[model samples]
Target: MTKNILFIMFDQLRFDYLSCAGHPHLHTPNIDRIAERGVRFTRAYVQSPVCGASRMSTYTGRYASTHGAQYNGFPLRVGEMTLGDHLRPLGMDCWLIGKTHMRVDAEGMERLGLSPDSVIGARQAECGFDVWCRDDGLWAEGPDGFYDENRSPYNEYLKSRGYPGENPWADFANAAVEGGDIASGWFMTNANKPANIAEEDSETPWLTGEAIKFIEQAKGPWCAHLSYIKPHWPYIVPAPYHDMFGPNHVPAAVRHDSERDNPHPVYAAFMNNRIGRAFSREEVRQKVIPAYMGLIKQCDDQMGRLFDFLERNGRMQDTMIVITSDHGDYLGDHWLGEKDLFHEPSVKVPLIIYEPSPDADATRGTTCDALVESIDLPATFIEVAGGKVPDHIVEGRSLLPFLHGKTPENWRDYAISEYDYSTSPMAAELDVAPRDARLFMVTDQRWKFIHAEGGFRPMLFDLVSDPNEFDDLGDSADHADIIALMYDRLGKWGRRMSQRVTVSDEQINAARTGGKQVGILIGVFEPDEVPPAASSKYRGPVPTKEKD
Candidate 1:
């Protein structure tokens, strides 16, 4: 039986970047070890391609549309339940060790009269987690001021370690010390230089130490969401990891000249995005990819340290480990920069789950090619805790069967992803209304379809024929039937009963049974068509006319 859960998430990690997943140069043996011990999902995708919304979906086991945190920095409306909410009922405590990228639902809290400092209020404010440490990790200060509202604990730690600056997170932690000058990590050119901070003091290692400390002191059943903020942006690594890779180690961009020729309107808009434009240059990629690889390598090394700690403490036998990412960076794929589009590189992520039980031993070092989603983690955790998965609450099916080495029948055929660009500058440039600035993606094994709101034509790619997703078959009349079928699937998904939280399932079921006893026939056609008990009330209806 699994006594604990260690849910780990890496920020902006690509699906094919790991050694086990066949990256030519960037090897991640520590992560691959988890895959070796359990099952690796090859086709797992996130609910969204952006950080905030994607993490919200993963935490809540629901789509971005259902959670209503559809974009970065968007609040996950109060009263929305998360993994913490689901597991707490089962006597499992959920604690945060690192970043959640959660923006509190302040407006909802205000309306409900919840104090931000109170215990329950704080849990609600911090996405239902009891905070061991909460840091969004981006403590950047510009001329306009700090990019975030909350104080970064990582920055405070750097300050305590004797790094001097108003923003040491940038000056030392992310910057390269070059002959008394601080080279900002945000510049791609500075990626080759090592960060000023010591390797042990780097973000990944510090967070790993914090998590180990938490586990050592923690009692009873608990889950530590060890979220790492690295390989995301400000691409710079500390010490040995900084010197690990070079320009030759970076792979060629997955873009082509055909993508630039008469692209779809929304696609073209993304291709022309500022980040996309910058990454399109080969020089920028060569300089930055090495740093990104270094950060990942450091993360993997920290994982080795973390695993060693668990083994030393004898906790490895009881903990169920899940390794995944919130979303993938475009990294110049498909003529894009960040993760916003529905291409495989942006939305698909590496998912590895290791259930520490004899039952899962049969599937060790195996790969599962089922279509999995980031939302499935909540249900998986709940099940691992030996609790009943509340079907009405969690939108995803549990992966317990898979973990037990059983292939489930009648699984979902398609994986879905959504993106809301209303708050993006692209909406302003394209003159799209916030309400209409949305896109939905539906994909099976062979075909991928993208449906944009506001009268925009759908984008379709036959993934079998065009694996790179460079060609747009939306304009081709030959694929019209396929496009219509995909739209139908999207429509079916949209029509699901979402945000229906007013009544419990038991109450709804009770109404069905209780109504029949009171001579009420739901969906009754003719008077005689009702049940015999219900017919009693209708047969005596003539008495009402006599009274009148």
Candidate 2:
């Protein structure tokens, strides 16, 4: 049995950036080590592309629609079970050492009378984890006040280290050293400058140290969700890392002139987005991508430190390690800045699972091309903990069978991803209603279908031929049949049984035997319709009644 889990999530890291995943310039050997020891899922996807909704789906093992956290800053409704809720009952302590990006459902908390200080309340507020240290990692302050309500512990640590500023989060941790002044790394032009903070004190390293501390203090079988907030935004890196990559390291943007010519309305709106327009320029890409690469490198280095620590401490043999990102960044691909689309750059993520078991040794260093999703991790963890996966609760299937070199029968054929852009500025620009602003992506190996609500036609991509997703095949007359088939699949996916929480499968199976006795056979008009074995039992059931 797996004694511990180190679930590592990198925010906004692209699937292809790592050298293990085939990036020509940028290398991520530390992350690649996890892949070398286990299975790397080449086609894993998340339910949503945005931070909050994506992580919510990951934690709850449910889709964004089922969890009701459809976008960033949206609350995961109270009473929804999460990974912590599932693992704790199996005697594993679920603890968080970094970001969750969870927005607590304060209204639901108030209505349900949950106090923030109580154990249950704390778990609800933090998405079911016992937080060792909670930091969403963004601490921007404006006239309206801080972007987040909670004060950043990293900011306090920066202030203590003699970094001077009203916002050390921006000035020291994210700013670059100039001759006499601080160059804010938030600016695209200043991306080449090294952040003033020491590399050891940067976000990635600091989180790693905290994770180590948590491991040292851990008493029993536990899972530490060590989420790192890097390669995400601010697009800057501290010393050494900042100087590591330059314009030469940046890859050419995967875009074409044909993508913009007669683009879909929603796609056009994304192109017009401020961040997308900024990233479209070659100069901007040259400046921004290098720092993004550097940040990823720093994260990899931290992983090296983390893994070495685990191994040196003898925890590696007993722990199962998972390395993945919540979702991929567009990096100006698909004419989009951030993730909010069905394109592979935005939705497809890297999923590597390393189980320290003899059974998993055969599949070591292998790649699994099967369709997988981020929500599947919860079930995988549950199984690794030697607990049965509650299928009715978790919508995803476990990868244990695959990890043991056994291919499951009737595995998923297509991957599903969703985006609710109603709260985004692009939705307003496109004049879409909040209720109607929804998009669902259903992708098989050869085809990708994007269905949008609010009077928009479906978008189709023949991934085998048009893998770059540059063509707007939504209007192609010849591919209408493929579009219809994909729609049928989406309908089937949408109609799956969800939220069967109150009733257990065992109870339902038991109820099956009560069919005729409870008058449930009312529709049986003919004796032949019933099975011969059950016909006599039901037919003579009303022969006598107990008179008391």
Candidate 3:
């Protein structure tokens, strides 16, 4: 049994949603079991909030700035080595089973045995993932559209199957709860969801079936990546799961038409930074929280299936398993949904890695509060498989030290997370939500500073006292020195890691049509927002969307 790696991930899982962490309703047995068998890290973070950049960091072991894979459609700079490229020579078969959202334009094809122009951007080609399948695309679709190839994945997967106009609350309440999240005939959240999605018309069960086959047949010392998209959106889970978490413990979400206090716009302004819109607290709790948690339970069940397969095959002890997410869900926290803003629920995530061995002391079945970034995954897995990470290719350190019972106190004194809200202001797509130009921020254990120029005053939060970030301490004379120090830190770090966009001649021509500057002007920091706490080197954003 050579060291095989099973890297399993979901799209938008939240850190606080795990049952092991005390959400009595979550019931995530498999993941909890893995935690019991390995290391459950309480403070894992991702470099960026979106899929593309986050994947870049996970595969390359560097910040988006350092690796230059900052956004979707943005290719990694030529010759930038990824951990996969580093491991192939070591005789480890690095196989990707689903969704590697890397850009597979012409160049990406050569890496995956496809021609970019001829092939639609498939999941496998983009990120050098060997084997892949994209989970119901984009997480939203219309009624009877859950599997539709053309409609949004979210809409289709979430479209209700019960009688129309029925109270969603009552409909879910009628579902049965047996065996405490025990697998019935089905194992997902939305078993009752209508089939006939154009792409997955037959049944999603087939997808899982293929996965079982993949696990059974994979080669030795293999590194496999499985990307699950259930809990992402279109928040429709199968029947029982929809009602799984008794209403009492469901996490609260923002409500529609409820926002009254968010006066400031997109931390600054730019394209894609749609005008901020307001939603009420109750709306999120009623419509949003239920759907989101339903999806979580659904994915949780699927994860259980994956683990059950491992256990049945007796591979649980021989494999090094990791469970995490690209990023987290906003779930109406800070009056937002999706990952973009700089809120804790949006940036902070859960990271659990299990290497089933007894002598592997200090980490097995233990919890570590060390601050870690998603960028560290690639390097961590590379090491677990008994390979050395190349010096030039890693911006993240391996977690082997922590696993070996030697986590240094200052291993990571501070963690960094970056965001790029670079969309055109006059551009067609704008979030009808709060929009700001661009803002930068940095957070240590206690304070958070956000800098927005203009009437958008900088804000400082004493997280120790105000974890919700409800108050601004920027104007206080007491924290001026700390503010100045953070600004300098952001400057120096940004200078070292930020990447500039390099568009080809064709892309430049396309941009010229709008008479807008198509070239990406990657900068060290977003135009300073009045600063309280801030990340040093973040870039880009726009104005347009207005919060109601």
Candidate 4:
């Protein structure tokens, strides 16, 4: 049977927030339902904690170092092969229904003479997906202009429905009405108040409706990426949902006073940053956490709607449904508000994949603790669409074998995450060079090591001893052996074949011995030293040098 893929991604959703993941307050029955029918990966991490870099990794099936789109506004280069590039060859149509957080490499495209109007160029510009509807959903307007320069369809929709403002995305959808004054949701104080818009017009529900419309009209054998941009920032929800949770329901922040005592310079810089300082306050957490929970609850309800639509249309039987997030929100965890650190709240995300084929029956509803990366999704989609994963380009291994209740040989022992902070204020505050303002996290089952570029020492967390990551062992002399071992692993990963994308392993192996057939043999001392078949052409064509 021809397979279809429904890839659903939520923005800033934590791995532990769902009811299935043991969250005590938030009940996500729809998301839990997906987990019940599929395998929930407990240890899945994104290649980067931030949205754009993580999404780029997910789309290209490569790490941030490989793809070179290492931050929010960084562009995925024009020639990088993405999920659509891989699956489209096998007669699978790849499409985007909502946000990709993908910035087009206009400079690279211009150098290559690729027009965004052309089919291939359009795909390349859109991170390889054919655009059904594209919205990055950050419509915040500053003094200069809107955060996203792209035209806002969401704003237009809000206007058409009589939302009274030039930017209803900020006015009605993201702001609260306080005594006839518009209280911007950008501030955490307004987070407890209901947004001025109706619930149906909120970003999550609107995006869900867009997804259902796309699936309803789409042809079979397709991969539709439904990426939502809510539960991210502007942490305010519409009425009813806004009051769903309060300060009482908010979990205690996962942090300690000891974490701030003589912290690593890099970590300290992040902690002292504006966002971190704000979230470090108890009042901010009390105001923001409840609204954040409400946004997720709204998303779960939309999931129920979308799933019910799929069931009614019989799309569930043929579609491989995947539910995951770009990355988790820090949400005051480790005294951080955003996802720019290597902590579990910032890097680890929820990953649930339901393969509709009976081959996946053996592993249904199981939980896998294997160290999985976000890059694995594209590899999984390529395999599901009946295409061989091009290992030279796609760095991630297919998860199909795991879904079929088999462990693939030589499975990865660790997961990697990268953060490029050159463009961030933290870099400037620390006086770091642009090239040196970077952090790499390599985490296994026992330890999580963070290697910061420049002259700073590495940060170490003994996950076995302190799973909550309260203690730092980077400065401890007793753990020198373990730190050295982790450094060796990081060096080995740095030497990976990230740029050898033009040739496959098979091609390299075939070319190794086939060179002699074209009379390019090297290191041959005598005719007898080489194979007879290889020396045949040289034997017949002996040319004597003319006296000169």
Candidate 5:
């Protein structure tokens, strides 16, 4: 009999939202159980924090550098190998049940049985999923079949219940000119909460039900890709869960009082922008985070149903249930919200692997602080399924070694990640004198660097000392060696990206351990940096932390 592997991902699920992660007030018991059963990775990262980009990297296991699907509008290239592709050929019956946000264009529309008219206000290609059940893009759909005009999700959801209005996202974006809700961050806050909690909401229950079904119908070695879009936005959960958490228990918002502090200007600008700026502690308490955690707990409660079904169907022992989020939600950790910033709160996500077998070590609740990524997930799954993960197809090495209790001595010194600053909405907001976009990053741990474009607006954070990521070592001559080394390493690593070179993990590791020195400042194991402004008082959890 083939093993049934359930790959579950929560949309915009932050790394620390899980109950097992020591979240004092979170409501995630089901996920907590999953952690208890298997391995929970502490420092798992996504390639890009944005949904489309992160999903693309996850689906393809290829870095954004080669994928070129750097942002939402950027389409994933055709003919790329995905987790689905690898499994399907092995007769795994891979099914994409919900939220395959892969931007299906006309050429790819037929497979999923979708048409141009199928989507109302958003562009949805039909063939994106093998068994699709999704609304318009990123919950940005209008009341397509439900109403007359384009309305906010709040309005469209209300329309399904006999209410109607313009799309809030659109409305809020245009509100400055329209003058309806000026300075009011209602769209992300109160307005969207009701729908989130409603059992009638299409996406949530649809996803949950399908997950239950997959657990029940597992006959053989099957792979079900269940993606949930909740805990992502609309900060709404149904009634009981909606009122699940009290405001007083929400964590405090963070602030950095360092003069040396200078983040990527993209984030700094958002901090100083009208709606942007580090959120206040009171804001994190009142209107900001409670709802986000509410949704987290909501996902937990729903996932509990899946767990119950697995045990009921007697499939618990034969299944390798993996739970992870595409990315992390920065719930005011550094004053950021749902993602795209190069802060720990945005990029890091909780990666919990639960393989229900008695033979699995009793001390299964282990956390690997070594930097890993979403791109490594597919290979690990393939390895666990006892299937052949083609050499060229898999990008990251298998976690089977770590999972199987083989503590390989001297794992790679670092896990490298790079993000091009020019791709975000925040970047266009600034029109610098000389138009130059610089590529930079934080290493396996700390010791950050930014290689400022004109060499004037630069940034560097000694993240070890300043976990807040506020201190900018950019202009300091004291850390000159670190700065120059980071820039040099950035050039080498950045060259592989911009230049498109495919080096094996062995080769990369060779460069790391074999002392075959290649590039600039190579980072060992450094701690992560905290983002700025994740929770806003007026906004739900959109701390307005802009990513570069």
Candidate 6:
């Protein structure tokens, strides 16, 4: 039987929001079901804390710094090998049904004389996936124009269903009906109100239906990336989901007053930003967390629908279903509104993989605490599709060994996450040069160390003693040893050979001994110094020089 992959990703989903992850109130049975059938990675982290960079890492199986799509709107440069680029040759047809948040490297493409209309260029423009239905899901209209200028199928679908306005994605799906005017979900004040659209017509359900449609029509083994842009922003859900949870269900924000008393300069800047100050208010959390919970609940329901369709069609037995998120929402955690930090709430994401092969049965319902990164997904997909992971291009190790109930040799000791705040408002407030406005997080089992650029001292947290991460031991002389160790790890990761993609390690090793066979020998002092076979060609060519 042919093996397939169902790569499902949710935008801005937190690690602790699901019931399986020990959420006291928000239950996610559908997401939990996948965890029960396979291994749930408790220590999975994104390569970056923001959406575009994190998703780029997952698609390319490389670090954001390596791929050069450091932040949102930064293009995934041409020649960067992504999931489809690796898996297609192994007979797996990779397709995208939703958001990748991938921007094309227009300059790179133009330099190479590649047209976006061509097959290769089109695949490169869409993050290496053959586009099934592409939508980045941010249809917000600004004073200039819509945030995403791409033609929106979701908006068209809403209009076809009898919804009014040119952009129903914003008006109905993301706006709440007030007494006379529609309150935009862009404003946190409208978060408590129900979205004007029907639950079935909402983004999650619509994407889920599209995924089912793609699976029903696929002819052969394929990797369907069903990425949902939900539980993200415009934190308002339709009807039943909107009222399912209230402020009472919201957990206390994991923050301490001590964090504000003399925080790291970089942390202080983020805390004092407009979004952070707004979310820092108690009333804002009360209004937003319930709506956030509702969005996740709606997502879980859609997962059930998608899973049921797969099982009824016998796709479950052959398909490996992976459920995860791009990054996570801060949502008032640590006095932050969005995901642009190294906090656990902003960096850690839920990762569940349900592989139906009998080889995975031994590890069913088990939770692995291995330090997993988002880049590992593409590597895993390539390996599952019967392709060898090219270590020169793909920087992550495959998780198949862990799925088969065995630990891989030389497993990673640390997980890394990066954030480029060069274009952020926080950078402007801090008066930092674009090059210096960077942050990198290197976390192992016990220590989570954050190294900020611009000569700022590193932020250190003792996860063993202070898992909440309220204390900043960055200036403490006592933990300097641990800080030094983490710095060394970060330096080692930075010096990795990430750019030698044109050749593989195997090719390099073979080439070392291959030169002599082709009759090209360097540094041979004498005929006696080499074997007869190597010097035979030269021995016969020796001739006496003409007298001058």
Highest-TM-score candidate: 6
Per residue, candidate 5 scores C-alpha lDDT tens digits across 403-459 of: 766655665444555455565445566654324543445455766565546344456
For each candidate in turn, give its C-alpha RMSD to the true structure in angstroms.
Answer: 3.9, 4.1, 16.0, 2.6, 17.0, 2.4
Error of 5 at 60 (Å): 0.7
lDDT of 3: 0.60
TM-score per candidate, in order? 0.93, 0.93, 0.72, 0.96, 0.75, 0.97
Across residues 1-548, which tens digit of lDDT does each residue of candidate 1 receive? 54899999999999898999999999899999999999999999999899999999999999999989998889988899988888988989999999999999999999999999898899998999999998888988888998888988888888898888777889888999877998999888898899998989988988998998899899959998999998888999999988899978989999889989988888888889888898898888888888889999999999999998999999989998999999888888787887899998899998999888999999889999888988888988888887877767778888879888887788888989999999888888888999999999999988999999978899999988999998899888999999989989999999987767666688789987764476556788888675677677667535545554
Full ranking by lDDT = 6, 4, 1, 2, 5, 3
* 1 versus 6: better lDDT goes to: 6
After superposing candidate 6 on the true structure, give the runs of residues whose Cα lies further than 4 Å from its correct spot: 525-548
**lDDT of each structure?**
0.89, 0.88, 0.60, 0.91, 0.61, 0.92
Model 6 residue 104 distance off true place after TM-score fit, in angstroms: 0.4
| lDDT for residue 68 in candidate 5, whole number 0-100 | 71
lDDT of 6 by residue, 1-548 (tens): 57999999999999999999999999999999999999999999999999999999999999988988999999898988899999899999999999999988999999999999999989989999998898899998989997898999999999999998899999999999888788999998899899998989999899988888899899778999999999999888898998899878988988989999989999999999998999999999999999999999999998899888888999899999999999888888889888999999989999999989999999999999999999999889988988889999999999999999999999999999999999988888888999999999999999999999998999999998999999999989998899999999999999999999998889888887664375667798878887788767777756889999
What lDDT score is found at residue 14 in candidate 3?
84
Tens-place lDDT digits, model 4, residues 181-223: 9999999999999999999999988888888888878887899
Q: What's the true lDDT of residue 259 in model 3?
A: 25
lDDT of 6: 0.92
Question: Model 1: clashing residue pairs?
Answer: none
Q: Give the Cα error of residue 130 in candidate 1, in Å.
A: 0.6
- Report residue 516 deviation for candidate 5 (angstroms): 33
Q: Candidates sorted by TM-score, descending order?
A: 6, 4, 1, 2, 5, 3
Best by lDDT: 6
